[model samples]
Every structure is written in structure tokens, then in C-alpha cells.
Target: MLFVPLPFVNALLLALVFVFLKKSNGATATRAFLMLIALCCLQSIVLGLRWGYNVDALRFVQPLLAALLPPLAYESFRGLVDQAAPGRFRLAAAPLAALVILGLMLAAPILLDSALVLLFLAYAVALARIAWRGPDGLGLARLDEAAAAHRALWLAAFCLCLSALFDLVILFDFERSGGSHAAILVSNANIVSLLLIGLAARTAGHAQTETNTEPEPAPQTATSEDAEIVARVDALMTAQHLHRDDTLNLSRLARRAGLPARQLSQAINRVCDMNVSRYVNDFRIKDVCTLLRQDGITVTEAMYRAGFSTKSNFNREFLRVTGMTPDQWRKAESRDLEQKDRMAR
Candidate 1:
């Protein structure tokens, strides 16, 4: 029997995501994200056909999807967060190359499952690393929104790991004529993962709207010149205390620093090893710490003064940067000061 509602709904939801994403504000990376989601949804259908319906003719779809997943995942991630992307056709060729690799898989069917599992685990680790660092690099966002975006990625990586587990289970089920539970679990997991991936694309994917107002500068090359750019940006940040603006964003910072957006982004990435959004938030975080050390200033007031829009945002960024909650950090500082006073006495 065909798995009608669930698999069909999964594909339909993925299609809707594709439609929305194509129209959404983003670049090559966004498109790659769409492709990644599409592949996942399609896998649900392919799996349904091969396993649920026992359609042996559609068996080829699995190897094709398997081959395309790893590169597409890595490329989508790079595009999502990087200042530059590979040439259009070059990026487009990844799946085609995967299709070409299918010949080797066909030649050695026994190695196919092992190789695919290894590739999935490798990309999952890479994705998790990028997520932990932050999603500020992926697109324009406020500090709070950037944290949410990165969390979306963390979830995506978790889902990918889950997908790999489901794959293994389905393989085992295929080997033993047993319960259909594994197939059901695999499809449902794909549905859940697709939903989260779509959320991440929405949360983090953005095209530069404000860039149209300014003359776009030529793309900066990777070179030592980035050092000077970073120094100048740092000076501007410190002198102006630009992070204190609650409305601060990459485009606005670029304007105030009198630098092209791309160059400024590159400088921040080079020197701070972070996206401009996170770099700015780091300043805000420091300011908050200083405020928290002072008496009579409430945490909410300090967070607001530091330019955070909400306490949740402040707490999330605080934990990520400081490894403690705002209240916990404040309490520790208070204890240290009390101990210092006793020593002075």
C-alpha cells in the first residue's frame, strides 16, 4: 500500500518551501538550501516507493540522492555564510558530479552504504561546528535573531544525524523481513527535519536590501590588505561605540565605517573571526558585563543600554559568549566583590 498522506504531505510541504525560498531574499547559498530541502523531501518519496510499495524499478533513486546529499549540504552551508560563492555553473555541477559518481557506486554496490554513511557523518560534524560558532555570518540579523538562526542550524545537524540513524535502521529492516516501523520512522523523521531546515532558511537567509542604495564595490580578494581594513573598522567601532545602536546591522555599520559591505564583512571575519552581527554583539555583551558589575542597574536596564531588544536575546547571547546566564554571571561577580572587600579590610 502507498504511504499516502504523510509522504505526500512531506513532498508538498517541501515544494512550498522551495517556492517561498526562491522568492525570498538570498543568494546562491539560499538556492543550495532549497536544493538540500528538495533532496530530503524527495528521499521520502523515493523511500516510500521502494520500500512501502515494493517498487523495485525506483531503486536507482536512492543512490542518486545519497550521492548528491554531502556536497550539496557543504555547498549550501558555505553559500549561506560566506562572503563569496563559487561561480554559478560550477556550483550547479555538484549534483551532476554526484550523478557521475553513481557509476562507481553501481560498479561496487557493497561499498555504497558505507561510503554514504561516512559522508553524512562528516558533513554533520562540519554543520554542527558552523552552527556552534553562530549564524551571524549567514545573513543580516539582529543579535537575538542571529542566535535563533544558529539554533536552527544546530537542530538541522541533529536531524541529519537522526536521518543517518534512520537510514541504518531501514537497511537493517530490508535485510530482515520484519515490522514496517523503521520505514514509518524514517519518513516521519524526514518530515520533521524538512520542517526545521525550512525554518533555518527563513530565519537566516537574506539578500542585502540596503545594498541597492549604495554603489556596490568590487569584491575584495583574500589578502593581507584585510588587516588594514580590520584595524580601521575596529577604530570606528571603538570611537563611535556603534554597537550601542539598537538598530545596528551590517549595512548600517558599513555605512558608518565608510567601507563597502563586502570589505567590512571580510574585515570582521578576518580579524574577529566572526560575522559583523556577532562582532557587534560581542561589544554589547562586554558593555552588559560592565553594567552588571555596577550596583542599582537592573539586568533589563543594562541589557537595553547595551542595545539588546529583549532579555531573552541578552540571556541567549550571554550564555553563548560567557558560558553562564545573566543572573548567574551577576551573582558570581557579586560574590567576588564581597570577597575582595573582606581582603581589603
Candidate 2:
């Protein structure tokens, strides 16, 4: 009996919801979510192609797509933490390049098989890097709780690595394997990977909602020194436009503000009622609005100048903050500007 797991169907549904949430949120998250979805879609296509076509070329393409998935996902999560915009063409580069390379490699089965195996190995290494390093300056402390977003990613990474290992084993021992055993292992691994990814999507969605729902902590009394530090950081963010710096990280921001990174993070969290990423994103969002209103700059250029690395992220964050997409925001800004022009006339 050919059986597909029910969890996969549930995962697909949840992934769709994540896509909607990401699209609503507008920038890096959206791009990340889209990359995630694309990976899943390609994975599904590869499965169908393998069985239906029984082509070595399709087999070669599957692992390449699989290799590209984790890096794109990590990049997406990085965007979420920073709310930094992403480059459009740059975002497309990995998957596009992977496809092009895989297409070329298909001319020779021996070469294609070896290349595909190497790609999966590299993918495993990349996933390990992300898992080990964590995000931004945020630590594994956040993932201590079972419900944390990082836990889902950790689980997903584990599943992907395991799947890749099994794939390598199958490839190396293809001639020795019986059909039933190979089919069972492949099916089971696919189901496990799908389940983990679904959990990750759910976790991300829940984390976003939880963050929004949590009440702001009450303001506490600050010593004069603390107050001064807060004021300086805020002023630099607002007046000096320090957040516009792509290289502007907590350590640099702290150095610029003449404070320790820990103290700066505490000050921003306690005094400003936000994290560093949110703080920087607030400025980027403001710049996006200003550019939309001005009418001279293209949206892509605005996103770039505003320090966004991807359109999906920019769009997601813009919509989340302002309740409108960049296009919608631009149209509304243009209308207002036109109305003002009429009044001046």
C-alpha cells in the first residue's frame, strides 16, 4: 500500500499559514518563509519526478535543492532577528545557481551523483554552523524552554542531517539494497523531515504571536547614568540615524554610544521597550515610509538604502509595522502628495 503520512498534509497547511503570516509581516520573514515553502515544493516535486520519471537527472536535482534549503532558511531567520531588508536578486541567487549547476551536471551521471552527494554534505555543515552559532547575539538561553522557536529549528536541523546521512548511505549502497527496505527507509525519513519542518513553522508562528501578545514590562526607575545612556542611544537612533548602518550591531552600537554591549542591550530592553532588532527595524520602517512619500526613489533602492537585504523581508516588516505593503504604502503616499500638490496649486 502506498501511504503518505497525514502529518505531511498538516505540515503543508501550517506552512501556508506561516506564509500568510510572513506575507502580512512583510520583509525578511516573508522571504524566508517563501524560501522555506519553495524548498518544500521542490522536495515534493522531486519525489514525484523520481517515481514517475525514474530519471537520474531528477535524482541529481533533488539533493541539490535539498542542499540549498537550510542556508536559505537560516538567512531567512537572520532577517527575522534583524528585520533587515534583503536584496531581491541576491535572495534568488542560491536556488537559481543551484538549479543551473544541477542542470549542467546532469549531462554526466557519475559526475552528477558525486556533486549531489557533496552538496548534501555541505548543507549539513551549514546547518550545523547556524545551530551552533545561534542568531545575532541571542544565545541558547532562549532555547532552554521546550516551546522556544530555536528548539523547532534545532529539531528540524537534526532531522535534515539524519535524512542527508540516510541519503548518503542509500546512494553508496544502491546496488546492494533491496527495493522494499530502501522504499521504507526513504519514506520514513521523508515523513520525519516533513514533521520537523512543520513543527518549526508552527513554532515560528507561535513565537511571533506570543511576542506580540506579551504585555510590555513596566518602566523602572533608572539611575542618572542609566538614563543618560538611554537618552544617548535613543538620540543616536533617531537623530543620528545610526540604525541605517548595515554593520551596526550591538557591540558597535555600544561602542558608538560609549557603553558596554550588555548594558546597551539592557537599556534598550528596559528603557526603549524593544530589542535591538526591533529598534533598528523601526528606523528602517520609518525610512521606507519617507522614501515612499518622496516619490523619487524606487522601492528596491529604498529597501537597499534602508538596510534591508531582501524584498520579502522588507515587505513583511513594512506590512507588519504599518499595516500595508510597500506598494500599497507608496500608492497611498502618492495620493496624499498629489492632494497636497492640488492644494498648493
Separately for all candidates shown, the number of backbone clashes (residues 3 or more apart, or on different chains) is 1, 20
For residue 29, give model 1's deviation from the true position in Å.
Answer: 7.6
- Per-residue lDDT tens digits for candidate 2, residues 149-189, read 54555666676666667766666666576444554455445
Candidate 1 on 168-255: residue-level lDDT in tens? 7766776686645765765566567656665555555433222212112234354567878877877887788888877566667777
Once model 1 is optimally superposed onto the true structure by TM-score, how far is the C-alpha of residue 151 displaced, in angstroms? 1.6
Query: In terms of lDDT, which candidate is strongest?
Result: 1
**Best candidate, TM-score:** 1
TM-score of each: 0.59, 0.49
Regions of model 2 farther than 4 Å from truth: 1-29, 45-49, 52-61, 83-93, 100-104, 111-114, 131-147, 178-180, 205-263, 266-345
In candidate 1, which residue pairs get closer than 3 Å at backbone N, Cα or C atoms, i.e. clash?
A: 25-207
